[model samples]
Target: MRSSTIRRALAAASTVSMLALSVSACSEDTANDSTVDFGYIGDYNGVSLLAIAKKLGLWKEVGLTAKVKAFNDGPIQVQALRAGNLDFGYIGPGAMWLPASGKAKVVAVNTLAYADRVIAQPGITSMKDLKGKKVGVPEGTSGDMALNLALEKAGMTAKDVQKVPMAPATIVSAFSSGRIDGAGIWYPLIDTIKAKVPDLEEVASTRETDSSFPTAFVAGNKVKPELTSKVIKVLQKANDWRARHPREAITESARMLELDESKVKADAANVETLPTADLVAKTKDGTVDKWLNVLGDFFVRNGQLESAPDPSSYYTGDLYTKAYAK
Candidate 1:
C-alpha cells in the first residue's frame, strides 16, 4: 500500500510539471506579439510632424504602442536600426544608402526636398563671397551634404572653403566669435540663429537647390513584415494632422523644441510634408523616381554613395498601398 501511494504522488508531480511548461510557452508567445520599439533621429525641422502625432495621440489611434527613442543623427539612427534597436524612424535620403546596401529597408519617403537654409553674417553677400571663408556644418549630416552640393554647383569644392565641423548647438557661438562665416542648418536652429544674429543673411536654401532629394522613413528588415502597413498608417495620420493644424502643430513643436512661436511658424511655412503612402504611386508614375534618381546620381557623382541604388530597393510600395487602400 505504501509503495503504491508513493508511485501515485510521483506521477502527479510529473503531470503538473508538463502543464507548467506548456503555460510558460504560451505566455512567452503572447508577450512577444505585443511589443514594438521605434526610434527617431534627433531634433530637426521634419520631426515636428512626428511630435504633433505623439502629442495628438495619432500613434494610439492607429493601434500602435511605440517606444519612441531619439538618436543624435540619421547615421546613428541607421546604426540603431541595423542593430535591431528600432522599428522605424526618419533618416536622411543620402544616408539610406548604407542600409540599402545591407539588411535595412526604406518604407517611404517622408520629406521630398531639402528644406535647409544657409545663413550668413552681415557682410557675406553671395556664394562667391563665401570662398576662403569659414563655414560651419554638422558633419556627416544632410545639412553638410546640402552645403557640399551647393558649393559644387558654384564651381567650388570642400577644399575651396574652410569647412568647420560644428554641432548645431555650437553654430551660434561659432558664428558670433567669427569662427565661421556662415552656418548651414535647418529650422529651429535657423530661426534661433536669425533671432540672435541681427545681421544674418539668407544666402541659399536646400529647398531652392535640391527640391527632389528624398528624406525617408526606414524600418529594420527583421521586423514583422505585416507591421509595415501599420507603421504607414501612423505616419500618414500624423502628416494629415499636421496639414490640417499647421498653427497648432507649430505651437506644439515650438513648445517641445523650446523656440519662439513666431520663429516656429516662419520655419513651418518652408516645410512641405509628403504623404508616406503617396511615395510609391508618385515613383511608379515617374514623379518620385525621376527626382530620386536625379539626386542619387548627383550624390554618386559627388561621391556621396558608391553607386546609385536600385530605385525599387530604396523604396517599398506594398506597405503604402495597403495602408492607403485600407
Candidate 2:
C-alpha cells in the first residue's frame, strides 16, 4: 500500500473518492421491484464489501437487485436513510450513531477490526504527548471519533490540542510539511503518509479499543421486517465470494474506489470479514451495547448530541442470527 495515492486524479484532480455514480442502470422500473436501494461510504476500504458484492452480481442471484449509491462520509448516508431513502446502508459509527438514535437499526457489523488509525511522529510515544499539538482530522466524522476515543483513553479531550479539520490527503500533506503534528485517517491515505514519512507510526487504532466500532449495515424505514434476512444474505454471499476470490475482490474494489490496485490489495489485507452470527453473539454479550454507550457518551461529552439514544430501542443483533437459520 506504500506510495499508493491515486495518481490518475479525480474529475477535479481531487484525491478524495469521487461521489458521482451511475444509478441510471438500476432505474425507476426496477425501484418498485425487489431492487434494494443501498448506500455505502465511498471507496473506503473497511466498508467496501458491499461494493464488491454489487460488482460480483451477488444481489441478483438471490432474487434481489441492488441500487448502489456512494457518499463521501457516513453523515450523508445517515441523512438519506433518515429521509426514507435506502433499505440498508454501510457506515461507520460516525453516521451510524445518528440513524441508531432515530429509526435505524444495525443488522450486521462487518470488519470488526479496522486500520483507520491515529498516527504520530516517533517522539510522541503516548496519547498525552499530543497535548497542545496540532492534530489533523476530518472533524465531525469517524476520523474525529477515533481521535477523540484515543484522547479519552488518555484522560484528554479535543480541547487538549488544536483540532484541524482537513481531508485525509490534506492532513497527510500537513503532517509531512510539519503543519500538523499528527493525523487521524484511514488507508490508502494513511499509506501515502507513511510512504512519505517513514518515521511516523501508528499510536492508536479502533481495533485495540475496548469496544469494536466495526463498520455496520443499518436498516431504515425502507426495510421491511421480512427483508432483513434477504439483505444480509447478499452480504454473506459477497463475503463468500471475496474469500474465494481475493484477487478479484481487491481488483474490483480498486476500480470502484479509483485507487491503485496494489494499494487496494494492501488495504484489503487490513480488513476483517466477520460472520453475521458472531456479530449477533457479540451483541448479546453487550459488546455492541458497550460500543454504543461509549459512542453516546462521547457525543454528549463533546456536545454533539443533546441526549444519548437508547441502545435497546435501536440496536439489535437478533436479525443476523435469524437470517441464517433454516
Please list the C-alpha lDDT of all candidates, in the order they appear. 0.60, 0.65
Tens digit of per-residue lDDT, candidate 1, span 296-326: 6766766757887766775666666667778
Candidate 1: C-alpha lDDT:
0.60
Quality of model 2 by C-alpha lDDT: 0.65
Best by TM-score: 1
Model 1 misplacement above 4 A: 1-30, 41-45, 93-103, 258-260, 275-280
Q: Cα miss at 81, model 2 (Å)?
A: 2.3
Give lDDT: candidate 1, residue 162: 82
Q: Please state the error at residue 294 of candidate 2 in Å.
A: 4.3
Clashes of 2: 0
Q: Report the lDDT tens digits of candidate 2 across residue range 1-326.
A: 00112211121113323232232333334444466677665443433666666676666655566666655455555667778776677666655557556757777666653656788876886778888988898665667777888887888888998888886556767887878887877655666677678888687877776565666777875577667777777676666666677788778777776666776677666566665565567777887777777778778876777788777767655666666564
